[model samples]
Structures are given as C-alpha cells and as structure tokens.
Target: DFSEGLARVKVGNKWGFIKEEGGVVIPPQFDEVYDFSEGLAVVKIGNKYRYIDKEGGFVFNIEFEWAQSFSGGQARVKFGDKYFEINKEGKIITQGREDLFPVKIGDKYGYIDISFNIRIEPQFDEACDFREDLAAVKIKDKWGYINKEGEIKIKPRFAGCLSFSEGLAAVSEFDKKWGYINKDGKYEIQPKFDMAMDFSGDRAEVKIGLTRYYINRNGEIIKEIIDIEHEEI
Candidate 1:
C-alpha cells in the first residue's frame, strides 16, 4: 500500500519502494519493508530491522529485533521481549502523556493522573486509552463508552469497539457485524460490514465477505482496492 507518497513493491523475493508514477525509487533489496511514516520507513534486512530515509539511506545504525512505523513522531521497537518508544534520532522516550494513564488494581482497571492519584476508581473489567474525550470500557462482557470523569456516556451494549477517530467510532453489536456510531450513542452507519476500521481523514476501510474497500463518512464506498501485482500488465 502507498503511504507518504511511496509504496513498497516486491520484485522476485525482495522488497523495495516505488513512486506513484510507477518509477522505481528504492531498488528491491530489503527482505521486508513497512510503509513510510514521518519521512522514515522500517526496513528488514536478514533478521534485523532498521529505519531508512526516502533515498534508501540508513537513518539509524542500530538494528532492532522488531520495529513498527512511526506515529506522532515516535515509533515502538522491541529488542528482547521489551518494547521501547524511540524518536527520529533513535533516542528512547521515557515520558508519556500527562493526562490520564490506564492502571490496573487486582483484576479491574481504571485511570490515574500523572501524579499517581486515582482519577477513576478501578472498577471496569477492561479499559482502554481515551480518544476524543471518550474511552471504551468493558462491563462484565459488554463494551461501552465512558467520559474522562468516569461517567457512562454510552451504555454497555457493544460486543466490541474501537476508540473514536475523527468524530465517530467503529462498534459491533450482538450480531458481530461492525458499524459506526456517533458520540450520542446513535448509529451513523448501520451494522453490515464483516469488519470495519476507524476513520482516517475522511475515509474508513471496511470488508464485506471477500471484498475490502474504502468507505466515506456517509457509508458510501469511495474506492475499491486492487492488489498491484494482481493488476493486468
């Protein structure tokens, strides 16, 4: 898939990058490569992973056992069963968000402030990070939305759900079919897709049976994805 104006392509058994105009930008060499993020991409050579620039130049001399694409100016990497967030200069980030952090006491989960004070008492069966002022929490076996003050904004009814992106969140009901919902606990897009992803920009990716495509906020299919290698030459 194309990301940040470049797409990784496979030639024979090696992976490389190409421009949108179908011109080879980075020759096929790496064993595996991830989509670029924040002007850098993770490339795997042999069993080690490293970051590389658009010109195929190595950004970091140190290699990691596993690495992920950069997001919000940082990327997570694993060395020996431990994951660490690193910056573009390969420096480990120790500080996290100052707002609220998920904390687990016994078997229940809750949120705590940066000063280690319990902001929300641990009561949820499961809790996730807050996004757009709302967090997804599990009560017994159902999922619901909760505000930062621990108020139940949306009742626990969904079988599964994701944090809100843009202005909506993807959720599943008893039928296990995924759909979208607004902040008021109203369905914006009816449940029908076999799987649904959070909206990125103005489009969200969805799957129905064996077909996967992009859908707009209005539940309209905007583009159909076709594998590059599968296209007729």
Candidate 2:
C-alpha cells in the first residue's frame, strides 16, 4: 500500500518525493532521486549526492563518489574511484576491489561481501547486477554470466548484455543487434537488433535506424516506432 499515496513524486526544481498524493514528503529538491527503498532513497543535490529518509532526514550523514541503492541490507557506494558496501545505518563496513565494478576496470568485474571483503574478485572485466544469484560477467570483451560462487554458469559469447529479468536476459552480438537468452544460456530469441532493450510485459523494445519499436516473444513486431529521425540510422 502507498502510505503517502504517491509511489514517486517531484518535489521542487529538482525531483524528490513526498508520499501519497504528492505530499512534499521529502521536499522536491535534487537533480535526481530514486524511489524509497528500505525507508531510504538516494538523492543528488547540485554535484554532490546523499541518501535521505522518508522523513526527509539523512541516514548517517554520509556521501560518496557514486552509490547503488540498498540491496540485501546494504548498498555499494564509491569513494575516490573505488567501490564498497555500507550498511543501512550509514556505516562503512565493506570494501570492494580496485576493479570490482568492472566497466571502468578492464573486461571483468567482481563482488564484495558486507565486510568490504572480495567475494568475487576483479574478474570478468564486465558484468551486470547479480540476478538469481548469478551475474553477467564479461571476459576479454565477450559477456558471459557467473554466479556468486564465481562459477561461470553461462559462457560469455554475446557482445553486450543486461542482467536477467523474468528468467531471461538481453544479449547483443554484432553491430546489427540484440536478442534474449534464458538462464541456461540458450537463445530465447535470436540476436537481431540494430538496438535493443529489456523486456517488459513480454514485449521488448527494438530499434530500426533511429526509431523504436516493440516486439513480442514470437519475434513479431507488435508496435511501431514513433517520433524517430528515420535518417539517423
């Protein structure tokens, strides 16, 4: 149930939150804001950012170079170009490796535990969020997915990818496009997009030139692209 009536809201000049029915609960005043999680939300004010509570309060008065929303009781926050995990109470309790985050590392990435300990060290060089205890990690440029135990569950072959959603993940292989795959690493849909995005309601977004279109699981174009610069291809 929505305690404040609004699940999301815009506060002032920037987007913040108030709860149900636009109550100005958090005071709309940030460059960007994420939905409330575990009673807290991440907000960016000016160039600096911090987390705020439902009561428009700060949870521990801490800030970081970058941050991920609280997950499994903690969130990954960055400092001085390095990533680490902090508890909900705003305490720095875990530290990530130099290249754990990956996209900026090389071609692989790893995960850390609550104690700032490396659970999965700097590996895949490229990786997406862990889903179903598995994360899509990249190696040498090809993205395969691995489990929390650092075991390669699905071998990397797709060029670009995203984490699993509804037991399927989107993967891309050549300059022409994107497709979907199952948890077992088998193609649910062939790689064939000029551009592609994740699936929502059994429909995924694909692009033709600069226009966007939606396709169903059977690979049928259910929707057409609109307002796109057709020449941008």
Candidate 3:
C-alpha cells in the first residue's frame, strides 16, 4: 500500500520503492522494506534493519535487529531481546517505563513488574496494559476490568472493550453495541453505537450504521455526519 506518496513493491526477491506514477524511485535492492513515514522508511539488508531516505541513501549510521516506521519523530527498534525507541538520528530516546507489563505464560496472560517479578499470576485468557489504575482482561470470550493487584473489579461480561479513559471505558455487550462504562462497571452511556472509540479530552467519536459523529461525556451528540462512505474514523 502507498504511504507518504510512495509504495513498496517487490521485484524478484528484492524490495524497493515506486512513486505514485509507477516509476521506480528507489531500486529494488533491500531484502525487505516498510512504508515511508516521517520522510524516512525502514529497510532490511541481510539481518540488519536500517532507515533510508526517499533517495535510497542510508539515514543512520547504526543498524537494528528489527525496526519500525517512524511516528512522532521516533521509531521502535529491538536490540538483544529488549525494545527501545530511537529518534531520527538513530539515537536511543526511551526505554521501558511501565510499572507492570503484560506477559503470557502458556495460554494465559499475567503481569510482571519492571524488575521482571511476577506481580500478577497468569490466569486470564488475555490481558492489556494498566490505564487509570485498571486493565482490561478477557476470560474465555468476555472482557472485564481488573486492578493492579489482579482483583476482578468488573466481572467479564462485555463482548469487547477499550481501556479506561477519563474514568470511563468503552464496552460492548449484547448485539455488539458499544457504550461507556465507569470504573465501577456501571454504564455511563447506554450501549447503542455500532462502533466506539476511547475518549480524548471531553469527546469521543462513534459510528452508527453509515452515520459518524462525536459525543460528549454525557453521551450527547456534539457533532454529526450522515451518509458518508465507510472509512477509518
């Protein structure tokens, strides 16, 4: 797929870049390539990954075992077994910071502290990072919220859910409808929308059928769009 005015194409066993007009910009030479982002792209040569400019020139002096496209002027790279974020100049900017990160053991998921100590035992079918002091966990197929201590604050009942944002989490129940629920598992807004997103500031975007709109924390429609072709919200 095309990104930032260029698309990745494979010729023989080598990957390269082509302009929107179907002309070769960067010749097929790398073993693999990722879409352009922030004016640069990640390309793999042998087992090492490196960033390259649009003109196919190397952007950084260092190479990574694995690298991701740049976003917000930073990209994630893996060295040894640890992942770190690097700036455009290939300088490590950030390392691990979460107090507890999710880890999988066998078929169940649990939480481990930054020191690699098991804080929560593996029991839930799925687990996510803590947000606002709670994390979304799944048992079998139902989703719910749990505290840092692994206590099930909200029983697994939702068909799907997003982590808490501004004290409310978007959850779906019967009929696949989505709504906002408070930390106590009480519905702040009734389930009705076909799709829902996490709240940013005071508003969240939602979709019902072909209609899309923004709703306030009170579940009131602040803005609406009708009969628009379905695309990313």
Candidate 4:
C-alpha cells in the first residue's frame, strides 16, 4: 500500500487492490487496472475504459476506448478516432490534446486548457512542460515562471533557468554562476556556483571552480567531491 492507501496485487489471473493490512479493497474483477490519482483510478473491462473510485465504484457509465490518468483536473480519453478531455465527473471538457501538450504557433509557443481555450498566449520564444504547477518559459534570452492560469508568477530575469523541483529551481544570470530560487522568485541560495543541479533529498550538487559538492537547503556545503572533472558549462 502506498499514499493512495492501496496497492495492486495479482490474484490468480486477475488484479485487485490490497490495503495496508493486506486486505483486499477492490475485488479482482477487471482485466487491467491503473494507479489511483485524485481519488480515482482507471480500470479496464474487456476493451472499454472507465474511472473507478477508491471504493471500487464506477464514477460514470460512459466508457472510452482508452484513457489517461487525471492531471490538472483533466484526463485525456479516446473514443473512436477522436480524443477528448474530461473532468473527474466524466464531463467532456475539450475535443483535442492541448492542455497536456505544448502548442507552437508561428515562431512562438504557448499552452491551452482542458476546454481547448488558450490559457497562455503564444508569446514565448521557447517553453517547457509544467512541473510542480509551474512552467518555465523564455522571452528573448531570459527565462521566467508562469502559473497554470498563464499568469507571470516570476518575471523573466534569469539568463538561464530550469523547471521547479522540490520547491526550488536552478537559475543563472550571465556570470555563469547558478543558484536556487523559491516559487516567489526569491533567491534561496545566492548565485555563486559555476554549476548547479535541482535539489533532491534536501540537498543539491553544485560546482565551484573545478570542485563539486552538495549543499543543503540552507546553502551549506554538506559534502564535497574531489574526482569530478570541470565540465563545460
């Protein structure tokens, strides 16, 4: 059992969910099952797909040929030759793959919502996928952050920037020194390293001069590496 409080287990030729105590929560009745997300999971019966609640109840009667897990309150579904986006209530929101995909218009990039409505206008020179509810976008040569609603949460200031990870993102400003910034665009670790990587397990690997080391969230050097070569930045 994981965070969803249930784990998939194989029983004979079928699959079911087991609780933390190894008790069956959902009986092995479906041909296939997917992990739960947003309190629902996708289950397959024969060649049809539908969502089921944590209690193993069907969320809606409409079944599709294929489906994807919910993300940002929407899931992609395929019926016949057309693809659609639907909400948790199984209501169709859109008719194509736009919110889950980046759209390119002319020389700019932007994104849409589950309704096929333009959430972000095509104004960025480049854009990256959303991570941790925010996406990194480039305007000319600087990078910034935007919320899912397409609002500029962080202004374009960094010469280079990466997507958010563990509440912080690595950024640089022309000097080739990298640092970590919070969601509010404030520098948690002052830009001083030659290179930096995303924070993992409360620490990040950074390079200064030719030495590499790991720094904690407080920007304290916790460990040092002496064998890593000074790679080109």
lDDT of 4 by residue, 1-233 (tens): 46488887778878778888778899998889888888888888998898888889998777678999898898998753346778877766744412433456557888755433456788888888688888989989999999888789999988988889899999998765899999999999999899899898799999998889999999999999877588899
TM-score of each: 0.58, 0.54, 0.58, 0.54
- Candidate 1: 10-residue stretch with minimal lDDT: 92-101
Which residue pairs collide in model 3, if any? none
lDDT of 3 by residue, 48-155 (tens): 898899999998676667899999988887643456677776766625434666767557888866433578998988888898889999999999999999999999
Error of 1 at 220 (Å): 0.4
Better of 1 and 4 by TM-score: 1
The Cα local distance difference test for each model comes to 0.87, 0.69, 0.86, 0.82
* Best-performing candidate as measured by lDDT: 1
Worst 10 residues of 2 by lDDT: 97-106
RMSD of 1: 15.6
Higher-ranked by TM-score: 1 or 2: 1
Question: Residue 184 in model 1: shift from native, Å?
Answer: 0.4
- Per-model RMSD to reference: 15.6, 13.3, 11.7, 12.9
Model 2 TM-score is: 0.54
Question: What lDDT score goes with residue 117 in model 4?
Answer: 45
Candidate 1 lDDT by residue in tens digits, 1-233: 78989999999999999999889999999999999999999999999899999999998767778899998998898643346677778866647533665666667888865333578998999888788889999999999999999999999999999999998999999977999999999999999899999999999999999899999999999998776776678
